[model samples]
Target: MGIRSVMLPAAIAATLCAGGVARAEGLTVGFSQIGSESGWRAAETTVTRQEAKKNGDTVKIADAQQKQENQIKAIRSFIAQGVDGIFLAPVVATGWTQVLTEAKDAKIPVILLDRDIDPADKALYLTAVTSDSVHEGQVAGDWLVKAVGSKPCNVVEIEGTVGASVAANRKKGFDDAVAKDPNIKIIRSETGDFTRSQGKQVMESFIKSVGGKNICAVYAHNDDMMIGAIQAMKEAGLKPGQDILTVSVDSVPDMFKAMMAHEANATVELTPDMAGPAFQALNAYKKSGTVPPKWIETKSTLHTSQDSDLQQIYDEKKNLGY
Candidate 1:
């Protein structure tokens, strides 16, 4: 994810050494989460704690409930407590210069998960562990193009929270990919705020404005929104997969279940184990003063019901707290 459409710089540097490395032994790390707004966020928190346990680190988690103010407050609290490190899943991209600068002044390293901060000043954080959201969106768009072939398809888009780096980047990737073919056109688009209720509400408005039957597909930034869109489609007396193709990001359990039921098409996997790499970087930096690369990328895999065993994947990820 980016404050810009492009990815962050890939330069590895000693900027991480600005804050003295963490002390050996059980370290206390504060985590400022974006909140359990979706299944993926919940699984991310769960996996973060699991990663902390694996590293014998004490994680002090603060739920921001998807507010920038709450996240800034949580980071200040972590700094006041003098935690060894901080894990921040930023609710939005900009307006972070002040708090992040404060963290730097306190000599606390902040590792970003899921979202990236504005690169106006990259020195504020240590490093970011994130997936290629643009690529994820491109994958979704590519799948839709191939599925529809040369047939004219009108798509309604369910976007994530506005101003989020991930949301902007995903939209850019999808928009760019779909631009390659004039046959695929996005007819309606709105922000779902990355919530199911808002997603359904937006889809409902889209259906009324555009004539549901005229729309060929729905592109959601996340699976939760796609599931909500599917519900809206069903309630409106339309078969989801058959009547309107569903393509979204975030391969959560419910998405796979919908896939098994043939209600959704494809979802690009946004792994919840973001903490795995964040903790790894923290540990390495603490133990031996290792400065990891500026951006640590996690793989984004595309899952489709048509080519894969949806049930087996659902069974594997159902217990993952998503």
Candidate 2:
């Protein structure tokens, strides 16, 4: 196996100190990541490792490559190895009952990071550390509504992977928000699988079908998709931020850079430090037998180029594995 290097800031070194954790050091946890599907995913993986190393804990990782079966296998392997705990970034929202049950039977706690599974049983995992994906979509939609107030703006949306809870909720949130404004309508929608190339390809097809001039703005499920859509629009001789509005999620460093360049309008921030809270909960549980809540909801804030320190933020986060 080869090593992928990443640089975490000094402040993140103490990330696991939250919730009055009882210093549960040297615990070995297994992480089943959903592959490096996007820049934010890679950054989340890096931050997970960085936080674990800070507290002298060990992390054994399995790259699921965006497949639920692989993640199931990884969880079973972690259980067999008697790891202290497991961290799961589920590829999809369902098909987790048997594997999660196995982990529970083995008396190993599992923490979900960056996403949630279906709420078939809340006892399946200790807690979910994720942002409100639905709200993220709403944030984008609200921003676009305010940007083009009361105009007959036709929106073309690029969705994430099918069956993923984030995708479903984001789509619903955006659609619900825009439904309030009769003038802002979604003319076209399709899955981009949360990848840049696929986003660009989908945007190209949307442009050809709907005509870029008639389309008013673009809303992508994530910023990686937005970046690709921006490229596609430029290739078609459409000025993206100016001629057609842009909004998406994930305040990654690249998105901030684009905002500075005035190519992308707005993004919702999805922090990659999910492991920090997960580790804290595990530490508190192991040392004091306290059960963490079923869901640890993270914040989803909006960002735009109008911010005073966009460039500084871009420079700071450039090496965070994004």
Candidate 3:
């Protein structure tokens, strides 16, 4: 679906137009990022800053270091500084009500990037710009189903942080998709905390526990973890793409590079340009009083070795801090 089709409440839409175009020119926004936990996140941060710069606005960023408390602190600080708007990539889905209410009371429009908070506090934010993570997982699962055909496969999953909404939803989607085929079984699962180092470490343990030969496939919630899993597979004297078919989310540059080398299978893209639509929606809201949808779904395109533009994709994404 197109980004502009997402709809938000008309009540909150009015707040976005208080100062109009003049205020948007030098718009000072505070972005609370979840930290550079993975390449995807780093790219998100890079794109967010770039989007802010493109709009002739200033963005003050606060790195939450994957801590919800840090994010809460940053949001409160942003409110104190009276930033025109706040962009939050919440580390978790809960405990955001009080601080978000504070931002609402201060008349600051808060936009969520890449993830969504609980529906209970949905009214506190202007809108959320994120991909349908469940759809991404389903895409990954669907690809694996087609790749494996009727073959019985033992799959291992490297998940994101335990409590993160993205992790939960992606897992659910994958499970739902694979449920259709009894031959596809997830034998082992663990959280990699969405970092390459953690993914590698967890994968090392998985390799040891599951044994290199019994595994038929591996699924990671993000490409970073899948990349780490690839290294572990290589070290274990197993060819990842050939021996244990790999599928993952987040079409980061390295995934394409892995695909080019025949070391990985497929990845679903989770666009880092979340801020692009966010800024556009904010501008539209301020300029024409448009109420953007509460949820802006980004593209969830799947990429595989068959894709001809691997080099181009890698080159384009390489400089995005991934």
Q: Residues 97-209, candidate 2: write the lDDT tens digits.
A: 98999999989999999877895788989999988888888888888889899779999999999988789989998998989999998999999998899999999999999
Whole-model Cα lDDT of every candidate shown, in order: 0.88, 0.87, 0.88
lDDT of 3 by residue, 286-319 (tens): 6787888999999899999888989999998999
Q: Of models 1 and 2, which has the larger lDDT?
A: 1
lDDT of 3 at 99: 91
Rank all candidate structures by their lDDT, best first, as comma-separated numbers: 3, 1, 2
**Who is ahead in lDDT, 2 or 3?**
3
Q: Model 3: residues >4 Å from true position, as ranges?
A: 1-26, 64-83, 92-99, 118-121, 161-164, 190-214
| Candidate number of the best TM-score | 3
**Pairs of residues at least 3 apart in sequence or in different chains that clash in candidate 3:** 6-293, 7-293, 7-294, 8-292, 8-293
lDDT of 1 by residue, 224-293 (tens): 7888899999988889999999999989899888988999888999899899999999988888999999
Clashing residue pairs in candidate 1 (N, C-alpha, C atoms within 3 angstroms): none
- In model 1, the worst 10-residue window by lDDT is 7-16
Q: Each prediction's TM-score against the native? A: 0.75, 0.77, 0.78
Give me the displacement of residue 60 in model 2, in angstroms: 3.0
Candidate 2: stretches off by over 4 Å:
1-26, 64-82, 91-102, 118-121, 161-165, 191-193, 201-211
